[model samples]
Target: EITVKWAGSHPDNPLVKVILRPGMQMQYLTTHEPDDAQMECAIAAMQTVLAREEAEAARATDATEAIAAS
Candidate 1:
């Protein structure tokens, strides 16, 4: 899988690309090594996405359960 987006609102060149392989290998290609701040922002962004996805999945599960009970 591949995804490209900004780490946050602003940076020298915030746009980054992430690539993942079936074996769980990951790659982050950039002109320079990411600083602590940039890594933190990226982690936060990933967590936010995961939280929203989990909430949506829970809602779907609840809906399915309700339908089964009817």
Candidate 2:
């Protein structure tokens, strides 16, 4: 779900790259400039994902501790 298109014809494409999954070696480049709203939405989505990951990790840790205490 990349928010940008390819840098095919844009001579002055921005030199920005976003790595979504380093383990899987997945990366994306944003050639076209995104609007302010789009950028904000993207940022929000990323933050949400990070929060979910953190919450899941915390839950897993708690469960492991509980099992160990039993």
Candidate 3:
């Protein structure tokens, strides 16, 4: 699973950790490495991801229903 989590503090950046696994095999990266200029970057990313997932799930359900009808 993919997730964005709190890493720590930074003087200039939001310092977020993007974790791409559960535990030991997890890989971490940060958007703070390049320092996002927008203060709402994290919030915006979250909203976009959630919206996209919801849309995809709806599309999948619709496709399943259409196939069942045919």
| TM-score list, all predictions | 0.55, 0.54, 0.44
- Pairs that collide in candidate 2 are none
- Report the lDDT tens digits of candidate 2 across residue range 1-70: 2333443344355542333234225324434588999999999999999999999999999999999999
lDDT per residue for candidate 1 within 1-70, as digits (tens), equals 2232332323344233122232233233325688999999999999999999999999999999999999
lDDT of each: 0.65, 0.68, 0.60
**What ranges in model 1 sit over 4 Å off?**
1-30
Expressed as tens digits, the lDDT of each residue in 1-70 for candidate 3 is 1222223232234333223234324433332354565647877888999999999999999999999999
Candidate 3, which segments miss by more than 4 Å at Cα? 1-39
Model 3 TM-score, 2 decimals = 0.44
Ranking by lDDT: 2, 1, 3
Q: Which should have the higher TM-score, number 2 or number 3?
A: 2
What are the per-model C-alpha RMSD values against the true structure?
14.9, 12.8, 13.3
- Estimate the TM-score for candidate 2: 0.54
Lowest lDDT sum, 10 consecutive residues, model 3, at: 1-10
